[model samples]
Target: MTEGVDPRELSDEDLFRELQHLHETRTDTLLHGSDDALERHTSRTQELEEEYLRRYPERDVDPDRLRSGARRRG
Candidate 1:
C-alpha cells in the first residue's frame, strides 16, 4: 500500500505500476521455488489473453461488437 492510495481509486497509471510490482514479486517468488499458485495464475492469464486475441481478431474492435461478442455464450 502506498500512502493513502486505495486500489479502486488509483488511475490506470497507478494501477499499472502496481501490476508491474506484482509481476516482479510473482516472478521472484517463482524463481525462489515458492508455491505453485503463481505458475497457475500466470499460465491462466496468458491463456485467457491469447484466447481473447484469437476470438477477436480485430486489434481495434467496434465497441458494440466487442460488447455483443463478450455477452454471447461459447
Candidate 2:
C-alpha cells in the first residue's frame, strides 16, 4: 500500500505545491511510468484536484479558456 497524506489534511500552500509538482511531472509519468505508477499518479491527482475544487468552489475562470474564446480565436 502506498501510504499518503490526505489532500484535505494539507495546508493550502502545501496542497498547491503538491498539485504543482504532480502536474509538472504528469506527461513524463504518462509516458514512462509503469502501469501501477501511472495509476497511483492518476488517483493522487484526482484527490488533490477534487480537494482544490471543494476548497475554492468559486475559483477564477480565465476568459481566454472559455469555449466562447476558442470560437472567437477560430
Candidate 3:
C-alpha cells in the first residue's frame, strides 16, 4: 500500500502470497532485531497480552490442562 510498491504487477495468488510473506518477514525482523529493540517489543507485547488476558480471564487456560486434553487415554 506504499508509494511505488505495486501489488497490481503480481497475479492475485502471487500478490496474496507476497503480502503474507511480507507480514511474516516484518514480524521476524521486529522480533529478532537489536537486543534493546527486541526487549522493548517483547515487553510491549507481554503488556498487551497480559491486559487482554485480564480482560478475558476465561480465555486463559493452563498449558498443562491443554496438554492433558490432547493426550490419549486407553
Candidate 4:
C-alpha cells in the first residue's frame, strides 16, 4: 500500500522496514491472491527493491545464489 510514497524521503530504518513489508505482502499475494493482485504486488515490489538497491548497493544479491538457493556465509 505504499504505492506512491517516495522511498528517498524515508529514513534508512523505515526504508528497510517498508522493504520487509513489501516482501511479505508479495509472498502472501503470490500464494493466495488473484492474477491482477499478483501483478500489482510484483510491480510495487520491484519499485521498492530498485530504490533499496540504489540506497544500499552493498545489499544487492547475486542472481545465481537466488536461483541456486545458496546463502552467503557470514
Return the TM-score for each candidate structure. Answer: 0.35, 0.93, 0.48, 0.64
Candidate 3 lDDT tens digits, 13-48: 654565455445557768667877556545544444
Ordered from best to worst lDDT, the candidate numbers read: 2, 4, 1, 3
- What digit string (tens of lDDT, one per residue) describes model 4 on residues 16-50? 88888877686679899999889877886787778
User: Compared to the true structure, candidate 4 yields what TM-score?
Assistant: 0.64
Error of 1 at 68 (Å): 31
lDDT of candidate 1 over 1-74, digit per residue (tens): 11334445655565556556656666666777445766654664454445445655786956557767767733
Ranking by TM-score: 2, 4, 3, 1
Instruction: After superposing candidate 3 on the true structure, give the runs of residues whose Cα lies further than 4 Å from its correct spot.
Output: 1-27, 30-32, 60-65
Better structure of 2 and 4 per lDDT: 2
List where candidate 1 sits over 4 angstroms from the true fold: 1-34, 61-74
Pairs clashing within candidate 1:
none
Candidate lDDT (C-alpha), each = 0.56, 0.94, 0.54, 0.77
1 or 4, greater by TM-score: 4
Query: How many angstroms is residue 70 displaced in model 3 relative to the true structure, after the best TM-score fit?
Result: 2.2
